[model samples]
Target: INCSFQNSVEFSQQVFVHTSGSPSFSSDELEIVEGSILGKHYKVEAFLGEGGFGIVAKCRDTTTNRAVAIKVNKSDPDILQQAHVEIFILEQLRRLDPDAANIVQWNGFFHDGERVCLKFELLDQCLWDYIRDRNKQGLPISEVRPILGQLTNALSHLSSVGIVHADLKPANIMVVNRHESPIKVKLIDFGLACPASAVMPGEFVGTVGYCAPEVMLGLPYNEASDMWSLGLVAVELATGVPLYPSENDYDYLKFIIETQGQPPDHVLDSGVYTEDYFIGD
Candidate 1:
């Protein structure tokens, strides 16, 4: 479903891939509202959500007469730099079949004024919203099973391509269509994704409760960390409550130790940050 909009959505003067000229703007200046146009092609219909990166707008591709989600990056320097990194990670992911990989279909990128806009297929709702919509009751095992399968399949593809999805959580997972039978989901938000070889120990990433123990421990990690987050997400899907429900790494480790017992001495000793949690050497 990758549509080539090159003939349609023209790129603005600025592009994230090249040209690092300093750009400045206040949040108000980049605000997008209903009826606004992006890249002179996407007609803003409604806002899906917003984040530190910027905003995701549910826009109508006036050229193709189709719906799409356009994530526009903020003009802040650091945020813009991160957006460039995201594009780098996404470019590596482009080789995989979006459907088979169970990942979001990226429709390439374009410069929307000074913002880096990423185009993606329109999705129904995120797992967080979906769970909340069900009154926090969670979903049946039958539903959860398939959803988990798709996510693992996505992780598999990511691994094959040597990418680590540093951030995997309910909010980053989107359901294609809630009303559709045999619900399908795709992993979204790769802003934290990076090459496995580039992993640096002691660098913390991922959502609080969903973060893997290795990541929290400041140990070298890979796809295994993503698997850990997936396990938490699956539990949340089935119970309507976070399995860890911990606010900080300390509480997170405490809960894990309580239920699963502390990690073996060797594992704990290997973590760069392990000393922070230990009372005795």
Candidate 2:
């Protein structure tokens, strides 16, 4: 991994969320079920997962006889806006080869009734499930290394276009195939992702444990925030444990300071939320 960011070594570290915040969903909101045909040609096979934005389903394209994954948004205003943002980012990503960049391939988008749906190449198990399948013992350095390389490749591409994944962690990373000799992975889920320039203060993003210092400390989030997340993920893959497993920001910051030492003074001083984390020097 030729990760050449200036602070690549320092920055390293979702479920999934958007700026509007998660909303309560009634059962009827997401109406897709197995055998349901979406966009007329894609037949739903199974529900893959659900997150802040919408439900992901494994579907088969009847016309082409190919497996596909569709993320069906909840049709609510905020969800629709989030879908548009993700599609915008995905379009920006088209400049890079999805395979070489180690990013998920987006097929396109369509409307499933009033809801917005995104089509993508179907992928295998997420890293979290893979680790759990192994009884959470974690991967050896040999295995962890390749995954990191792939992820770094993914990040490098995102950086070129000034995109911040916002949520980067094991669950959001998917293995192309577990049996493949040298494992391959792709970055998934962009509901929380945004252009680095769009990042704003007081708008929370990403899972607490995997979130970066700038995000937690109320500073502007840049592409570097995603790198911080990648670092923590590198550790989790090798250790099978999160370095800062805390629901509280203060607790998480404390764990980070204990393990990595206090953040540089300028880092602390720049945070809008710095007062919450610091007292008199």
Every model: Cα RMSD to truth:
6.4, 7.7
- The 10 consecutive residues of candidate 2 with the worst lDDT sum are 7-16
* Model 2: per-residue Cα lDDT at residue 189: 90
Name model 2 segments beyond 4 Å from true.
1-17, 20-28, 262-269, 277-281
Look at candidate 1 and tell me the lDDT of residue 220.
Answer: 94
- Go through the candidates in order and give the clash count of each: 0, 10
TM-score of each: 0.86, 0.87
lDDT for 37 in candidate 1 is: 92
| Model 2 agreement with the true structure over 91-128: per-residue lDDT tens digits | 77888899999999998788778887889999999999
Clashing pairs in 2: 11-228, 12-228, 12-229, 12-231, 12-232, 13-228, 13-229, 13-230, 13-231, 13-232
Deviation from native of the Cα of residue 249 in model 2, angstroms: 2.7
